[model samples]
Target: MQGFWDCMSLWKLLLKGKKGCHVSSCRVRRLMKKKLPQAWRKSAVDLEDCLKQERSLYKQAKHTYAAQWRKDFLTVQTKDAKKHQWKSRKARDRFFRLQQMKQREEARHRCCAQSKGSTGDLQAIQIEEHLSDGTTSLRTITDRRLVEDGCMQETRHAMIKHERRHSPVHLQVSKDDHVYFWPRNPENKGSKPHGLHNGHFKAAIQSPSIAYCDALFRNIPLTTGFVPLQWQNLMNFAIKKKPGDFRLSKMRTIQLMNSEAQANNKKAGRAAMQFAEAHSLIPDGQCGSCKRHQAIDLALSKQLVWDLLILQRRAAGWISNDAKSCFDWVAIVTMLLFGLTWHVLSSMFNMLSFATRRICTGFGDSKRSFCPPSAVPFQGCGQGNGAAPHLDLGDTVHHSGEDICASVQAAATLWLGGIRATGGAINPEKSFWWLIDFEWDARNGQWRFCRKCSAAPEFDLKIPGLYSDIEPLRRLEPDDSERTLGVMLSPLENHNAQEAQLVSKGLGVPHLFGKQVYKHLEMILRHMLGGTKPGAYMDANLQAHQLETGTSFGLLQQDYQNTSILASDTWLKRVWKELESLDMYVAFDSPALSLRWHHDALLIDLFIDLEVDQDDLLWLNWCRMFLQVATVSDITTADGRYIRQCIWNGFRDDTYRTPYNWPRTVRPGRPYWELWQRTLSRALLPSHGQHHPLLQPLGHWHDNFESWNWLWSPTVGLFHREGAAWTHLALAGSSTISRRYAPSGSHSGTDSLQ
Candidate 1:
């Protein structure tokens, strides 16, 4: 029947005297209007050619026919012309679109079919095989056909309700329904996100007493949609038993199997880790010390916005923060939440800027691998098809030492591309944390530091006077097909674009080029022998891969797709700038750029600098690779392409923006610094003396400019004891020299002479 219709159409075309019907073979005639194409390349070319032919025909018809002839032509050939025009589209596209739609409909039908069995289905997916004292172990039947999104909203509500009911405690949440924080584990391999509360956070501090805990439990007010009673009892009993001092001293004992203790204790852990692979645990979370509390307080100083009006409104350009102390928890939470709240409200109003979807994965207290968005079924966060916005919680206040383990573990969710941030990033279960964004006023040189923070710098290993004249370096955008050892500029353009949209609380001059905002960052690659690049750098895909997945390009392809899954790609830019500003490669043989101290937030505010031990520097390259993958991130689009260039600058000469001046509380014993040092030591140190080459001089002998020792004590004082550790350092106090020689042995200056 369709062939007959096709023949009829062809007859109509022939009677109307179609011009392009010259091919005579039956097969050719049959396929003349078929317009079938195979590959993407062919389809693209065919589409272009078809458009051109159509244009030529239109032009020819306009001039070739008289007005009366044109009327007759239109009347005689209307249907044929329409059919031919439709045929101009490649058949492959029509087929592909039909296939895509079929796939979508099939997927939807499959979901509906599966959902039929999930709601009150009582399906025995995971059967509880072992019930240890504090743990419940289960083995689940693999049913790939189960659609996560269609698993019934009531099922989730039931889980939450059952868990809360068992506990018999809940805080009435404001109808605002806070957005949960969903940070990722390095790979999608660790524990998933879970809810956190008082005992949950305090476990890391001191074990709760039966009386205090019991009283606290009794007193915990119940609220709607909170943890159910069953899980509450499970948690209460598990934590009620005292676990001895697992403070900073417990860092070494990662796994727990106490043969000396009760069987109940063992069972509790089994239950927690075995509930589902998605379960993440929140160990005791408390500020272990006064200093830690202060640190946490400082990090979490930003204030939360009270209402949706100020909390949710995105602009087109120029989102700035100028208060000196405004970059606190409230600010970060505000930044994420305000953006997200606006997003949610926008969704409510049907006003999303683009076709972004809702994240719907439920992260539980288990391995971080299950930390996926609860909204989208397959892919989680980023605008692209892979992961989502890796919004990491960086506020000092949020870094409670005793609670970090708990917080990182319990509150860890997969916040794909900052999408699941309706209630702001902070778990609204408590009031101590907030994730907001602030700004830095470049023109006036002011920073919006967090308002509620009162903590002072915990450690300040001052190494004053540095490259004061290192001019401000604007991040240049990577040209097509070329990547280099400098700050990429597209980040800046994207940053500007995002600031306008309230997608980010950016620094620099945040401006939107179009609807998309570029990311602005600073970069400086080592660009030397033994470095990872040239090969790594030239592979534009590699750079993009790392920039997106926050992991190695090689690792990314093997592990996941759509790799923009890091917390903050901007941090990578900062590393690049530091290298460029220091001119790390060339030994300062000439009149050198001044050597001084730097105290950016990455240093003092976070205490990452004090942590690098002498042995860990060798793996610094690898460490950087890991950390960049873990921390920094960029924004891309749905089809796996960057919307704009991230502009990276090499140097910035702003006096107020002193990358050198540091906070005072960045000493060895400080919590974060110590933790980083320990991490570096563990990563770099070996049992045999065969340490990595970078590690050798972290303290004693290497000449790398960015070494822990060099960055900390850049210049050993001239007047100090002559034979001290500082004295043995290369060109100890010389501003222009970087050669190796023992301290001038001829010098006989005595301390008494001074």
Candidate 2:
């Protein structure tokens, strides 16, 4: 019987889920297993006998015990669930009747327009009237639910799924002026978040305007892949008004379309066409004299410049994951937890939720344009160069391959032109670009593609594919296999195993699904506490490596984003491989990128406008001298003008963004103020661990140094004042140590320093 229970235990963790019942059920079952007769275990050997003898009784016992445990585990949740529920039908009726009575009495006392201290039917009805404007207000009738406006505001934003909960779909003449909501009270003991997008993040993004809607673009990605040739042809045709008088690229003529709320909420395609026509491209200012090159046409130059900059930035580091790692974790976990998470288990129940095999974003919202509250009427600043109509994937799907290719290029060109200097943030982006790559499979029939689209570089030249196709969930990849002492391990080990079974395999969190997670986890455990092999590593080197370089400082995992990479493959590979040894990386781009090499780190940075471009090389040289990279060679050009460069670096010699960390923005300013080694080293190192160096919040440097400052707090190694000691732990400038007095030429002394 004990063996039989153990067998079930391995498979049925998610199967026997309840609000809080997991721990207790295990205890009770264990107790029963100990008490059961040894002969009874033999009855479970034969399938028929096992079922006939004790299956029902075992299930009943487990269920009863599990339920009790769950009640205890989630007592707060259990209580919260009863917020609005009545005990019986009669009680429910009585509550409503009382609400009605109160409303009637209020009507007699106050104006029908406004009622205070009211939790009556009239208030509810009035709120309903207001809701017509397309708003969904999550209300908490009890005062205890009223959280401080500032404190719980973030939580409130999370509840409003802008995609589904658009602010009151239609405008309504609302009678209730005061919109009551379930306020967040941080002081409440039971207060906790239930989903992604926590308080601070939600607070930052909340906008109480119209429904959180995305820009409706007509040429959105489609069911069937568009033909690259046809797409390009369409764009060429659109722009062929006259050769010299280049007009807006065909792709620039974007239009918006509404998206369905749910997958099955399909509307007529004709309505979509109507939407496209209604919201056609924004006008671009025309040329006053020569019609040759309108602003729209000239804007390409800007786009071209931006494209190059993006390439440069990408080389620096900004990547998106294409391993589908995010989706896989969710699928596996959902499967493992199917028995427990769902309301009730079915005979056909699988631990993982097969149907919910979707990508799970940590918290950041999807990449939709963020616009102000009002839709500003766009006038063509440059002929056909301003706000154009949005494009959607669906329209492009119906188009030919040639048109699709052309559209893609045209869009890319336009996108590249609108670049701006966002200080350090802009440099890596300007240097390199990261594009997500996906494989094609025909396992599912959801997608169709044109095989020949490859030659055009506008579409996949590899093969036709669909999005519906995916491989089955892998139970345990060898890469992720960790070994613990099978014999000595306790029955209930509360460690990453639980996280793996639930969050990783069951809930399917994406980050943990990757190969890197396993590698890092092994390093982390070995460094912290010794355990068995595979599951627990005793590799001191690996642990020390993680301690000094990697982010597994005995923590579960590291969180980072905004990875970019230069277009140079050789450079990217070299940089990544190098980082493998040093562990100085925080993805400026995706992991799959190749970067361009920059011997002159500062020289390879962003210059507002290309020509009048700042001598980044000279700047880097200056930095190296100041930061104490004085002995570090190969950081400059022979002529000393800093290596002449462009964003189009492809060759190994051409500067790229890889071998780069942080890929900092080099805004045009006091170039010689800091050392190149310090700046580059700072960029190379992730702002992780206990010691992060602060670049004295002085100068017109930047404001968003929060992530950087936090990641690389004081290195606490050394310091150099004007008179006293001097060391270069983690402060800014290897050579620019904290000096009490100005010593020489070129070094400007600030009053604050004195």
TM-score for each model: 0.19, 0.15
lDDT of 1 by residue, 717-736 (tens): 23223332333323533456
The Cα local distance difference test for each model comes to 0.26, 0.26
Which structure among the candidates has the greatest TM-score? 1
lDDT of 2 by residue, 485-515 (tens): 1111111122464455454335644664344
User: Which portions of model 1 miss their true places by more than 4 Å?
Assistant: 1-102, 118-122, 129-592, 595-754
Candidate 1: worst-modelled 10 consecutive residues by lDDT? 313-322
